[model samples]
Target: MYAAVTLFVFMCLTATSHADHHHHPCHSPNMTGFMSVMTLKGEVRAHGAFTYDSMGKKLRFRSNESHPVNTSIGLDVLMFFEEGVFYEIDSKNQSCEKKALQCSIHPMDIPDDAKFHCAMNLGNPSIEGEGFKANVWTGDIPGKKGVYSMSVTMGCLPVSTIYFMDSTTILFSILDIENEIKDPDLLVVPSFCQGQPLEETPEGTVNTFYNEFI
Candidate 1:
């Protein structure tokens, strides 16, 4: 009886440990990231937390030596079905007149009902070691450059985006990617955001925005 009880207790502890390992809301992308950042101008530093997944992206950027001492935040909920083709939820990440007007680098207004934007092969993609990398051009916004990277390691798949800038480098990394995004509400814009149901695919709307420039 004593030996049996001890075995049962050990089994319970092992089960609990396994459950704890997979309990996070999102999966870590791969390897330890946001590790260190290096700039060409001899400035290197670490920043804040960043999270990404099928639902969206959230990042808090800390100012470095080259930048002003301010904490700026950027959150973008995104989805992708094809290569270089994805929908960036717009209500929270809005541009003027549904991207009708030119966007400024200095920040602009967020329309209550902004449609999703399509990001096509803005540029070509390349690979870095076991990861993937690409630099694309987005012409609707003021700046027309962006970067995307991805890697899968030890059952953790992390996808990241680094917006290209002549001045600064910002990275959006998604970690611990498990659990299918079964919640439709997450993909939907809240009523307060004033977004209407999309008529066609979100990718179609983004295509229209780019058609004007193309």
Candidate 2:
């Protein structure tokens, strides 16, 4: 009886450990993906492709942004955290604007303080192999009065994110994520940006890829 009880206890501990491991936060630091932002009213604010290299502390975003008064514009933005600068390039007119990197950089990963909210299936969960499994996490945005939630696949691929800010609700959908950074050159600063004077912008007015989180 004693031996049987000991075996049962060991088995229980092993099962608990396995469950914890399965729910742990996992992410890929270097990846390329498509990202879109929309309002709660379903208006798409911007859609773009982005490449992130956390190890090198750099990111690139090619965005097609819609404006309330002006026509849609395509812009390419490159951010180098190590140099504390960012460049905005207008490809059509060959204009580049350089500015100081004012916003804090948030990594493309699950935050350490994020808590596991639930497990969900992207499609029909009852049907085997029909859809992918993902985990949802929620946490408060640091230094902000907001909550951020994200869903990621079992392989740590981001599916979507939602931000609840003071007066706005934004939804970010991530798709077609490739776990590898195919073009290392995408993070390089363009030659057009060289020797450009840094334009001074008001604080908290700089719109950046990572600014949505903070």
By TM-score, the best candidate is: 2
Question: Which residue runs does candidate 1 get wrong by more than 4 Å?
Answer: 1-149, 154-156, 159-164, 194-214
TM-score between model 2 and native: 0.72
Candidate 1 C-alpha error for residue 91, in Å = 11
Off by over 4 Å in 2: 1-24, 64-72, 81-84, 105-107, 201-214
lDDT of each: 0.28, 0.65
At residue 12, give the lDDT of candidate 2: 32
- RMSD in angstroms, all models? 18.9, 10.8
Tens-place lDDT per residue, model 1, 15-124, is: 32322332222233212223223232323333333222322321111222333322222222222222222233334445212122222111011111222122122123
Could you give candidate 2's per-residue lDDT for residues 1-214 as a string of tens digits? 2232223323332332322444656655688987766666656666778898867778787774554412224757788866778888876776898887754424356766677766654447779887767666677865457877776777777766676678676666776788778898888776776789989878667545556323
Per-residue lDDT of 61 in model 2:
76
